[model samples]
Target: MSGLAALCFLLLQTGACGFEILGWFFRGKSLTHEDITERAILNTTVQVCRALALAEGKDFTFPPQPFTAESVAVACGASKSSKSFCKAISLIQRKNWNVDLFRFYSSRHHFDDETFIEGRKIITEGLSAVKASNKRENFEAAREKLGNILHPLQDFYSHSNWVEMGNNLPNPNLIRAGTSIGNIAGKYNVTVCLDEIEKRNA
Candidate 1:
């Protein structure tokens, strides 16, 4: 009877230890949805602000006062601006908005890689469709469509494959593409392309 009692105690202790280790592993390695949202927003905001400042011939500064999504959207959507500048603002707004929504949904549910990849493809297709529409209406439609595509991304981040999805993204070249596209689109309205051109020249 004493031997059985000792064996039971050992099993309980081993189980407790295993649970503790598993807790530590998940705590150290996993990223919460909030973490992903904040990181994406912060990174995109900084990049967008820098691009805006350069376009406007102003010195680039961090944490520009009163920065908000609405403000950014308005700045980019200005009708009086060059098409390129407007496009940059539009792109930044869309990208960040998509990421924000993606994080929000991801926090609550599971999503798969095929979903995200398919969503991206849809966004690209939508962009193509809008290019031929009336400029203002086209961009607005594109923005709306982008919001739709981001819906699934939010839920996807909650899945076990979230990290793997991030890892599978196309890398920095896409970032460069975004930047270049913004500059070209905004060039007629602002001089954001100057720095990028100088870099290419050098």
Candidate 2:
């Protein structure tokens, strides 16, 4: 077996193969926003740590797959018992889930009801909020706002034609001011390949 495969086999004995286990559990089911958000969070954390390590000209060991806040904290040189970072993780996850609950009345918050432009506006404003909060050293508030925005930002891919437009990567323009996010599919207009996805879902 390869090194990663051997490690996964060992971790499996301890029930610590996080992504392996999650992949099995969610095999047939569609990923919830919480799952997606957590995965993205872990990925972002790992990439940032990698970049920082490179800048410092140091070797960086990655935390286990599907990293938790504690693991990431340790890998990034923060205390594993750090409450603030863990709290930030929980706050972000809760905010991501809350959109399904409290924000149900606002379809644009979920990129539902064909409110594409409004959803983009929420992301733009939320990004600004994150920056402003960070500027004030309100890390908790910044994380909260990040979680709030991630919901609609993620929903855009699920509910729109950014994919069918032949782009495999995320839209960079979403964060750029005054730039178009490309042509959005309207309520009256049908998004290409969306019907195929619905058919698959059904």
How much is the lDDT of residue 108 in candidate 2?
91
After TM-score superposition, the amount by which residue 119's alpha carbon in candidate 2 deviates from its true location, in angstroms, is 1.1
Q: Tell me the tens digit of each residue's lDDT in model 1 across 19-106.
A: 1112223565444332333334434545555676799988765544444444443444433544544454445345535444455344
Question: Please, what are the lDDT tens digits per residue for candidate 2 over residues 131-153?
Answer: 78888999888888877887777
Candidate that would win on lDDT: 2
* Collision pairs in model 1: 82-189, 84-185, 84-186, 85-186, 102-154, 105-154, 105-155, 106-154, 106-155
lDDT of 2 at 177: 58
Score candidate 2 by lDDT: 0.67
Off by over 4 Å in 2: 1-28, 185-202
- Model 1: lDDT equals 0.38
Each candidate: RMSD: 24.2, 10.1
